[model samples]
Target: MSTGTLYLIPNTLGDGDEAALAYVLPAPVRERAGTLASYIGENAKTTRAFLKRVGTTRPIQEIEIHELNVNTPAGEIDKLLKPLLGGIDTGLVSEAGVPAVADPGALLVRRAHERGIKVVPLVGPSSILLALMASGLNGQSFAFHGYLPVDANERIKKLRELEQTSRKAKQTQIFIETPYRNKSMLDTLLSTCAPSTLVCVAADLTLPTETILSRAVSDWKKKPTPDLHKRPAIFLLLAH
Candidate 1:
């Protein structure tokens, strides 16, 4: 019997409105998303909402959603792929952006590859890639350090280290913070990075209020710090 494929689905960066969905995701991805009956996601509520927006024909209640998060045990991850082994195609989705890139879905993807199940990644909006495209940074060579330390002092130390690495390797550093902590993160970046270093703050990406600005750290200090509180954003920094 042929094993089922594991579809890596991508969701919107911010509000999953019709316009953003229509603009970033291709027609084929939406169509394929509708056909899946089982899925693994970071959050069930948001997963259902995204499925509805993608025009799923299946009844929302009937769709099977297995939760996968930081707390999910590594051993239990194999069970999440059992449906695929039974010849039922299953999708992996995140609360936002592409699944598995910076999300816990990567664990399931890795297990699928070990089991030799076909894995397919559908085209969708990714705040990281979108920010990099607009940041005009060293996209060819860059690194994504998911999230910095939450402690202010540690965060500052980490920021300085990332800046030093960027300068030494000429590699762009990309990172993010929880929406509620956005302002604090921005403050740390402004205070810690070198004055001449280039920094890009891409907020509310793929949304109507989307903003992408790249400027020298010195310039950012002169203007009012952007109000990023309670908003999703991607921060990019480069020493060159």
Candidate 2:
């Protein structure tokens, strides 16, 4: 009988390491920290810390760290995750929020399924679902378009297309961009979508000063917009 396990880990939202210990494994597994596997990014320090909280005193070798790339091919993802999938349990995590929801764990999960590996999803905060919950938009039918294009002209064209598609399909179009580019994306949406279009901006999600506001495209002119560079944000466009 071949027995292996993969634990999907979620990074704490906003709060620091105080709650991390609760998310780790028990004492003896904590003693086998080195045997644990970590599937996170190089810049994912908070996530790495959470894993260490579980592994405890385990040897570093047991603590395998698989560097995941959101843009990589499935074959490449399989190559990087071979060991964890073959014998050891793999832990998939995003820097924040649940893995595979606009995170890099989709390929891992799909590959694991193809290999007949058992998978488990843990409880955690997901910025997307949280935003949708608060946005007051149609949550039943929504699509996450991931990050938008950086090129201004192309972005406008794509937004126009999405606006039409969203309206016709009766689906909410959700997307995000780099924090620095958020303002520009907002501007494009305002200019591209119909004046009656409903747009929602969910900024600094899960933080102390979280903001989830939905308003008409024409009404957006009535209030001050987020500086975007000051904080991270996600945008949702709905047809109402």
Candidate 3:
């Protein structure tokens, strides 16, 4: 009987460097990548370098490709996964942060599970968790609504709805936008949310020059952070 495996990688911790990265990823994942590299005619060094902060490794029989919206048919996921379904090792990685946390790795995971493949989530830094940690808001209850609406008017309407929901639920509301749209998103947030509501902006998280600032919307309205171009960020709303 063969066995399959999935390795969940984490985002960078404080910064994207070897020393800071060492503590954020699972040690076992690093070890496992070494082992897999040996079988696949690849160097563990390169593989390790590619996955410096994703996950610790483990033994498995197969590894499926980890991308999204491929032309492959849904039924074919089973066939392609035959090698790993019984007992293969796989890894899920997002561009930044853990897979499925505003990224597109969930489809592959769901398909894998339908076939009885064992899924292992490796411990690592999560941007959402990091944002919540620094938000200075009610962490006990919160909702991550993924990316906000792209259209301006729709986006503001959604933000208003989210604010109302947050107030009633007494939970923090978290959302994000593509890097280029950060400025627009911030503007809409400022215009839409109440003046007294507490807002947290976490930019370039885990990267050099990371900033986690929490203050009233009115304060930010005066002197806003520079346009968040060229940086990844998450925003949180905590009603007082």
Clashes of each: 0, 7, 16
- Clashing residue pairs in candidate 1 (N, C-alpha, C atoms within 3 angstroms): none
* Backbone clash pairs in model 2 (N, Cα, C under 3 Å; residues 3+ apart or in different chains), count: 7
Assess candidate 1 and give its TM-score to the true structure: 0.96
- Model 1 lDDT at residue 152: 83
Q: Best-fitting candidate, measured by lDDT?
A: 1
Question: Candidate 3: which stretches are off by over 4 Å?
Answer: 11-15, 37-49, 52-66, 69-76
Error of 1 at 147 (Å): 1.0
lDDT of 2 by residue, 1-240 (tens): 453566666655555453443443234433333345545452455556666554534654445576676566666866755665567666676776677778777877787787777877766677777778888888889899998788888898889888888899988888989877878888889888898889999987766677778999999977888667756688999864
Candidate 3 steric clashes: 16
Q: Give one digit per residue, the lDDT tens place, for model 1 in 33-114.
A: 9999998998899889899888887897899998999999999998998999999999898888899998888888989999
lDDT assessment of candidate 1? 0.90
User: Best candidate per TM-score, number?
Assistant: 1
Using all chains and alpha carbons, the TM-scores for the candidates as numbered come to 0.96, 0.82, 0.82
RMSD of each: 1.1, 3.9, 4.6
Which has the better lDDT: candidate 2, or candidate 3?
2
Error of 3 at 178 (Å): 0.6
